[model samples]
Target: MKADTVGQEAADGLLPVLRELCRGAGADGSLPLTPRALHAAREAWGAAALLRLSGIARVLGEVRLSRRAVFHYSNPDCPCCRHKLTPNERAFLSLVRAGIAGQKTAATGAALILTEGGPVEPARNAALALRGVWSAGPV
Candidate 1:
């Protein structure tokens, strides 16, 4: 199958595992993730993928983890190349922020930009350092 198709299928299969891990890890389920919890979640997801239990593992290995637990982006392609971001790219990024966990403030969600190459640890680390800029005034 095509890489994109494989990635979608893998992500589809991985979501349940992630949810289960979140529940087991005592995730709020509603609120954003704590740094520690996000780490655990990332590890759990990676392990699941590593175990070859789901296709997501193959794609996930390529994702980079962002500081915020969830990333929101309109396009699924590489921002620079405009090419479709491969499953490996997503997985590599997913792992990038495995160490970060906290409520983001500046943006409601993060943007997972696609880049070509092996894992970019430095960029991921920088992203982790950013304090979540919470939304404006009172709720």
Candidate 2:
């Protein structure tokens, strides 16, 4: 993940935002993975992370690609997604937001999972659960 010009943390943290952006796609059908979309995402995320998240969501059967190169998530408002996250989840969110925004997680001894886009990718995908937990990390 770090090797992809973006750190693992930000890459993970942006998943929820990416998911939401996809949710916001709504009646539009799909959102193109373009620079315009990247700009619409909070500055805490970058193009690389967005692309990676899009890929991961695609693999997870969450995002769908259309002939026009646009994508949308499977379910925008699943009931299970409304629950609160755990401490580890919060930690990952903090690190992800920090990394994307070019900052650092304030938590001491915060050991977070890292990856280079392999099996660990699924673990990183779970960070998408951090959607509603970003009240402090980043917008």
Candidate 3:
């Protein structure tokens, strides 16, 4: 996991939210997360998560989102490095690929992602945070 990701998860309050995403990814843990129960989740998680997802949609180059709730990652490889993405990475990539983007104005959604409401273990949090950004490979 990346320090920046841990920092962001700590500061932004995205672990449990991400945990929930991982929970939804099912046994395989591969990306293109299409959580079966999104309507119920959106209410509990708020639309901002979707907006954060939109930011994800903007970040990844290959993906297909049928709607704000539906996410599909075409090439679920790390944009920065072609690493075997973790389940947590898959979930974040889903968000990164989910539609409903509005980084510039999705204040409500962004706040939901950062709202103080959960605990994030350092190691686990680091792994989860690492899913979002690119990392360098061994030289």
Prediction 3 TM-score vs. true: 0.24
Off by over 4 Å in 2: 1-49, 52-81, 105-108, 112-139
Clashes of each: 23, 1, 4
Per-residue lDDT, model 1, residue 45, is 46
In terms of lDDT, the best-performing candidate is 2
Clashing pairs in 2: 9-96
lDDT of each: 0.32, 0.38, 0.32
Q: Can you give the lDDT of residue 110 in candidate 3?
A: 26
- What TM-score does structure 2 among the candidates reach? 0.28
Candidate 2 — worst ten consecutive residues by lDDT sum? 107-116
Number of the predicted model whose TM-score against the real structure is largest = 2
Residue 49 lDDT in candidate 2: 52
What C-alpha lDDT does candidate 3 achieve relative to the native structure?
A: 0.32
Candidate 2 lDDT score relative to the true structure:
0.38
Instruction: Give model 3's clash tally.
Output: 4
